[model samples]
Target: MKRLKYIMWYTGLLAISACSSERIAPDGETEQNIDVHLAAGISESDNSSRSDNNTYIKTAFTTNDEIRLVNTVFFNTPDFTNENTIFTYAGIENNKYKFTQSSQNDTSGNPDGTGSTDDTQPIGITWNDFSPTSFVYMFEAVYYPGNELFSSVPSDQSNVENFKKADLLIAHHRMPLEDRYKDIELTFHHAFAMVKVEATVPTGVGGLPKNAIQEASMINVQTAYHVDYTATIQNNGLRTVKGIEDENYPRTNVKMWLQSITENTAKKTQTYTFLGIIPVPNPNDPNEPIIVQDDFIHFEVKVDDKTTKTYRFVPKENAIHLEQAHITVLKLQLGKNGVLPLLLSAEIAPWTQASAGMILDEEDPTDNTLSGGNSSDDQQGGNQSENQQGGTEP
Candidate 1:
C-alpha cells in the first residue's frame, strides 16, 4: 500500500509541477531560494506545554525569493517487521490449499513479482497472529515561488526577510489510533504523533545586492504564541502487541478542527479542519489496494494590523476505518500581517467495525451435512436405528 501512495504522491507532484507556470528570470537578477533547518526538542520556556512526554521539534525555512511554500508533513512510525514487502502464494489446486511461492519476482525475472493471481494460484496470504512492533514518522516540506527570485540562491536581504516571515511552532500529542482500538477486545493501543506548522508570515525587505552596505537591521521576528496538540493510546487488548507495518496494520485517521478566539469581536469564531489517514497502496502492485487519499482542510481569514485573530481546532468524530489503507491531508492558510493567533487542537477516534471479509472463518458446522459419503447414506437410511439398537457408534 505504501508503494501505491508514493506513486500517487509522485504523480500528483509531477502534475503540479507540469501545470505550474514557468517564471523567467530577469536579465541579471538571481532567483531567490529557501532552505529549511529542523531542530528537535523544545526550548526551556515552552517545555511546560509539552504533552504525552513528547519532545518538541522545530523547522525553519529561509529564502531570498517570494515563494509559495508547499509543506507536506507526514507522521509515519516505521514498521521494523518489514511488513512493507507484499507476500504471495502460488500453485493452488483448491481454495483451501496453495503452494508458498515468493511473489517478489516477475516473468521478466525482474524484482516486480506477480501480486494477487487467482488463476496461476491463490497468491496473497497473511498470518492470522501477527502484531505491530515499532513506529516511525516522516515529515516533508516543499516550497515553490511564484517568481524567479526563488529559483536560485536568494540575495541576503531576501534571505533575512524569509527567515523573519517563516513560521516556527510545534504540534502537541496527537495519536493516530485513539478510536479504532476503543471497542476492540484487544489490550494493545497504537500511539503516534509529531509537531507541525502553526502559522507563517512574510518579511517586508526585498533582495539585497552582494556589494550593498551592511547596516544593523532588526530582521529577526519571533513566533508570537505557543501551542501544543496531544493524544494518548491506551492498551485495551489482552496481550501486548507491537506497532504494525503500513501494509499489514490498519490506517490511523486524524481529524483537527480549529476555531477563532480573540477579543476582536467582529468574527468571534471561525472553524478550520484537518484530517490525516494512512496505509496508502503501493503503485507497483497490480492487485495492490486502492490509494487512500489524504483530506486537507484549509481556512483563510483577513484582518488588519489593529485586529488579531485566534484560531483553535478540535476533533469532532471517530477515526474512520477501512478493509485496506488510505491517506488524509489538511492545511490552514492565513494571510500575512494578520495579527491573529492560531489555536489548534485535535482528537482521534478509531473506526468501530472491520470491512467485509476481514473476519476469520465463523460458519456454523451443525447445519452442514455430507451429500454422498456413507455418513450421508446412513442418515438417509435412518441410520439412527443402529444407535437405537445399542450398536457401537463410530
Candidate 2:
C-alpha cells in the first residue's frame, strides 16, 4: 500500500484532498536530555567479525561515518516541512569511539562523564525541545542524509549501473520518547542484507581459455531492494514494524555488479568477489520476530567476456540477519567442465569476523582431507583457520 500510494502520486493520479490535520510541537523547557550508547553485536557463528570484513587497507576497521537521527514521524511520513527532527552535531563518532568535540555545559554535552569507552556518548538529547508526541527517532548510517526509504535510484548513484555500487543502508529503529533522562541504548539493525558471491571454476575447466577465467564481470542482478515501514506503537513505547520487500511489486530498479575481492593477479586466478550490499527488506511477518528468510539471491557471472553463468540460491532455512552489516556468502563452483549441476553452498557470517570467508572449501587448509570430512570441524564450519592463529573474534 505504501509503495502503491507513492506510485500513484508520482503518476499524477493521487492528489491531496481537503482534510484538516492536527499539528503539534514541543514547547520551552519541555525537553529532557538522554545519552545515546552503542554496542557491537555479531552472530557467534560469524567469524568475519573484525578481520576479512573489508577493513581499511585491510579487513575489519571501525566505521567512521557519523550516524543520522530522524524523527520517527518523518520516516512514517516524510515532510521536509516538518521541523520536528534535530541532530546534535555534524556526525556521531564512529563505533567504538569517543567524542573528540570540545564539551559544553549545554545539556547536549555528556550527561555521563566522558570516558574513552567504545560507543559511550558524552552528549545528551534535548528531549523536551522536540515534539512531545514525536518521541521515536530513526537511527541510520546512509550515504547521505534525507534519503528516501523507497525512493528511486538516481542515475548517477552507484546502484544505477554496473559501474558503481550502492551500499546505502538504513536500520529503522523507533525508540519511545521516554521520560527517563538517562542513558538510552539503541541497537541499529541492518535494513539491507549483504550478498557476497564466491565463484570458482575448477583448476582445469575445459570450456574456457586460460585467460577467460582471469577476469570476470557481473553484468547485473535484479530485485526489489527499497522498502518502507508502517510501524505500530507498542506498549513499551517502542514501535514494531514489518519490513516488506514485495518481489511481486515493481522492481526497485536497483542493479548490482559483482565486486571481485580475491582476484589474484599474480596467479591469474579469479577466486572470490563481493556483490555490493543492496537493500533487501526484512521479510518477517509482523507477528514473528525479525529474521531474514526465503529471499531469492540471484546473479550472473560473465568470465573473460564469455561463459556467462547464472545461478540462484534461496536459503532453505534461516539465512543471514540484516544486522550490523553481517553477510551471507554464496559459493558457486561452476564445475571444471563448466556444465550443468553447479555445486553451491551457503554460509552466514558477520563482516570483519570470518578469516576464511573467501577461502574455498577445497583450498581451505582446515580440511582434514578431501572427499572426506571431520565431524568436529564440520560443526565448526570446517575451517579453524582463525583458531589456529589464536585470533580472537571481536
Candidate 3:
C-alpha cells in the first residue's frame, strides 16, 4: 500500500510539469505573442535577442502611425465674377453739344448759350458707351493648411507623423484688355462682366475639415473716359478800338495780355507740370533754392464784335473732362469636408443711360438730325402722356 501511494503522487507531479512545459498557440493564431511564460523567459535570454525584438516593434508602430496621419488632402476656391457690362465713348461730338447745352440750363427750364447758369451741374460721362466693348470674368482657386496630428513620443518620434498637415494650392485665370477691344474708355456706362470659380474635393483621401472648404465667385464691370481741349491766340485786343486810337484806354489790359501770354509760354515750354510745387534742393543754387509757383493756364481767343475794323485778337483757354462708372457682383460658398455648403452674396452697382436715337433708328434715315429730333420728341411725348395718366416713367 505504501509503494502504490508513492507511485500515484509521482505520476501527478510529472503530469503537472509536462502540462507547464507544453507550448500553447497564441490567441486566434494572431502574430502577436501573449505567453506569460515566454515573456518571463525573455528576461533570461541574451541581450541581443531582447534588443532586436524591441527595435522591430517600435519601427512597426511608427510606420503605422505615419500612414494614418499622412492620409489627408486639402482644397479651396477663390472669388470670381460673371455677367458684366461695359460701355465707351471717344471724341463724342453730339455728347459735347448736349453737355454744353445742359451746362447752360437754369432752374426755370430756360436755356442760355453762354453756359453761365448757377443751377448747372457738370455732366458725368462714362467711357464704355461709344463703341463695342468687352467684359471680362475670371475664376481662381486657392488653398490653405488643414488639421494636423502630432506624435506623442517626446524625442524618438517627434515628427514621424508630420505629413498629416494640409497642403496649399493656387490656380488663376487672366485676360488681356487689348485683345478684346480696339479701343477702351472709362467714362459713360457700366460694363457687364462675368467670372466664375469652381472647386472640387477629391475622394479616397481625408478631405478638408468641417469648416475649411470654401468657394467664392465675383463680377466686376467698369468704364472710363478722358476729355482734353486746348486753344491759342496770336495777338492781344487792348489797343486801338475800331481803328481809332483811344488815349483813355487803360494799359492794364495790355499788361493782362502779356501776363496771359507769358503763362502760356511757360506752360508750353515744360515737359511735365506739377499740380502743386514741392520744395527741393536746387543743384545749381545750393545755398538758396528758388521757390517756383505752380499754376494752370487755359487759353481762349475771341474777336471784338464791337470793334469789327480793329482787327483785335484774344487768347483761347483749354479744358479737360473725365468720367467713370463701375459695377461689381460678389458671391461666396462654403462647404464641410467634401459636402457642398450654403452660399451668400450680393449684387450692388449702377445702371447706365441708353442712347435713344441709336436704339430707335436701326436703319439709316434720309436725315440723321431729323431722326434724332423725332426720337427726342417721341420720348418727351411718351413721358407727358405717362404723367397725365398718373403712371410712373422709367
TM-score of 1: 0.16
lDDT of 2 by residue, 238-309 (tens): 222222344454333233344544545554445655454544344445453233322234344343343443
Positional deviation of 194 in candidate 3, in angstroms?
4.2
lDDT of 1 by residue, 167-285 (tens): 22211222133221211111111111211222222222221111111111111111111111112232221111112323423333222222112222242222222222222122234
TM-score of each candidate? 0.16, 0.45, 0.13
lDDT of each: 0.23, 0.37, 0.20
Q: Hey, what RMSD does candidate 3 come out at?
A: 41.2
Q: Which candidate achieves the best TM-score against the true structure?
A: 2
Instruction: Please give the ranking of all candidate structures by lDDT, highest first, separated by commas.
Output: 2, 1, 3
Segments of candidate 2 deviating more than 4 angstroms = 1-64, 71-125, 131-165, 168-184, 203-207, 210-229, 232-249, 252-257, 261-269, 281-326, 350-394
Collision count for each candidate, in order: 61, 17, 45
lDDT against true structure, model 1: 0.23
